[model samples]
Target: MIRTILLLAASAVAAIFSGCRSAESTASIPAVRPFDAERYLGTWYEIARLPHSFERDMTKVTAVYTARKDGGIDVLNAGWRNGEYRTARGRARFRGDSTVGELEVSFFGPFYGQYRIIALAPDYSSAIVTSSTCDYLWILARESTLPLETFRQYKEQAAKLGFNVAALEYPNGRPE
Candidate 1:
């Protein structure tokens, strides 16, 4: 009887831990395949994003990625807020396949967040990225501004993917 009870407790503990891990995983989101990480390296401007506490009232946001010696990617995200530029440096590494746009990024040590690219332009000019949850989404462009029509198209794509498009805010205030 004692052995059976111990086995049940162990199973329960394993189930609980697995659930917690999945909560922080982006397995539900399908990342873009055939992605070229080499071409994706460089600066990308933030066009639009769903509201988040860390990026509140920020404008002219941008992200820069570079190849790291350890085969990881170095990340630098910056935004203009309160009349000054605020920046956060992070690191990202591929979760599995390098050709797939699924990465785990960490700004805080040992606590990684999902960085999944759901859409991307063939020429690497624009992209739509999301996180483990539906709450995090971003539209990025090579230039600071994208054509108005292109922006709308990207918004529609996000909407189709079940993102809350209506809640997205333009960091530079809607492309002109």
Candidate 2:
């Protein structure tokens, strides 16, 4: 009876702690319905994102997408690094049809990572992209600047999907 009691107590404790970490999760993350890939194709300015090593100190970043002849997407990521313009070219392919909003993108050759369109404006003015893992998140806008109200709305959307918006890094290194 004592062993059973201890096991039950341990399980309860584990569940409590896990719940404290986050309420957002992959199972709860949502993607836009019927995402229009054609309108989504073009230049997007990075307003904020979760920082990663590959893009360290990158400012004035932009992601330009163009459809390739092979029915895949060609990605061009450009930024100002150490006062010099730097760019990385990659490719993206949809997991299903363009409307599904599921895709994979890669900066390095062959290897790819998940890229899901979680939230998008009807006019294609702004978008929020994240991985299925919900660990990687990006807030992109058609212009370098975003309206205050719109930014807040996007933040709420990302938070609802389980992203830690408080940790988002503005590429210019200043809190807005």
Candidate 3:
């Protein structure tokens, strides 16, 4: 009984903190409209990202997205950590209008995180993605490598959105 109570207490505390964090992070961030989900679906190579605990020491990261019959998206994120390949599966759904680029993705049951596509190339060849918070950011491309100019342009966009662009880690080698 004591253990169960303790667990409940911990969960309550965590929920409170997460609510606060999400409120602050999601504020003022706008998701691109007239977004084409079909164009965005596919494999994306991670060129750079801000360091985070979940992806710590990870390299060669990649994310795969596919449409689910339920009008949601299946997310497959893979990477190499300490020379070992690891993967995480998640699900995502648009927070509001399907045409918007804002989504809520959940790897853990019932706990969703914000996924906002802040920038994308005209041809959908590259993109800049981030969470509700400034703590998470990613530069992704359809190919394993992105052109230097394209990479720089994405970084600048993230910086303008309040992310720490200087802290991005290029696990696949920095774009030349």
Candidate 4:
């Protein structure tokens, strides 16, 4: 009888712990406040990001944002692969269904992914963006580089949002 009781107790403990992990996953992801999309438009260098198949073996990545007449936005992503420069043009539209900091971006035809500006510097010098699933992430800067402290803060914020910070890939270390 005692053996059966202990087994039941152990199972209960495991189930409780599993629920706690799900609570962490369900925690809402936060976005930056007072985001100015106009001021945010321009060339931004990609400092780091979570590794993805599309960006494999890429370096010196950069993005340029431009406004469209329809109130949507244009995205030009460029990088160097094997000493050759490659680029991808896409479209982004603010998630009118939700907050201003949330946008939907698409590289392929008509399909979109959630993009939230989880962090941004007051002067618009730096920004960190990520997907709602915490699968895709990027650290960008108006200049070629940002302070080491800022980098750490971005990682910390991403961690709080339930992301895997260890997967971050620095394309060009401390870009010059």
Best by lDDT: 1
> Can you write out model 1's per-residue Cα lDDT over 33-151, one digit (the tens) per residue?
99899999999998998876667788888899999988899888888888997777778899899999988777665656668899899999999987766667889999999878888
Number of the predicted model whose TM-score against the real structure is largest: 3
Task: Report lDDT (CA) for all predictions.
Answer: 0.78, 0.72, 0.76, 0.71
Residue 35 of candidate 4: its Cα lDDT?
Answer: 71
TM-score of each: 0.84, 0.81, 0.86, 0.79
The backbone clash count of each candidate, in order, is 0, 0, 0, 0
Ten residues in sequence with the least summed lDDT for candidate 4: 1-10
Pairs with steric clashes in candidate 2: none
Q: Write the per-residue lDDT of candidate 2 for residues 1-176, one digit (tens) a residue.
A: 00111222343355467864222335456567788777889999888887666667788888888998887888888888788987777788887777877777766645565677888888999988876455567888999888878889889888876788888878744335
Model 2 is weakest, by summed lDDT over 10 consecutive residues, at: 1-10
lDDT of 2 at 146: 81
Local accuracy of candidate 4 as per-residue lDDT tens digits, 27-47: 276677667788888899888
Evaluate candidate 1 by giving its C-alpha RMSD to the native, one decimal.
9.9
Residue 41 Cα positional deviation in candidate 1, in Å, after optimal superposition: 0.5
Stretches of model 1 off by over 4 angstroms after superposition:
1-26
Which residue runs does candidate 4 get wrong by more than 4 Å?
1-27, 97-99, 174-176
- Which order, best to worst by TM-score? 3, 1, 2, 4
The better-scoring model by lDDT among 2 and 3 is 3
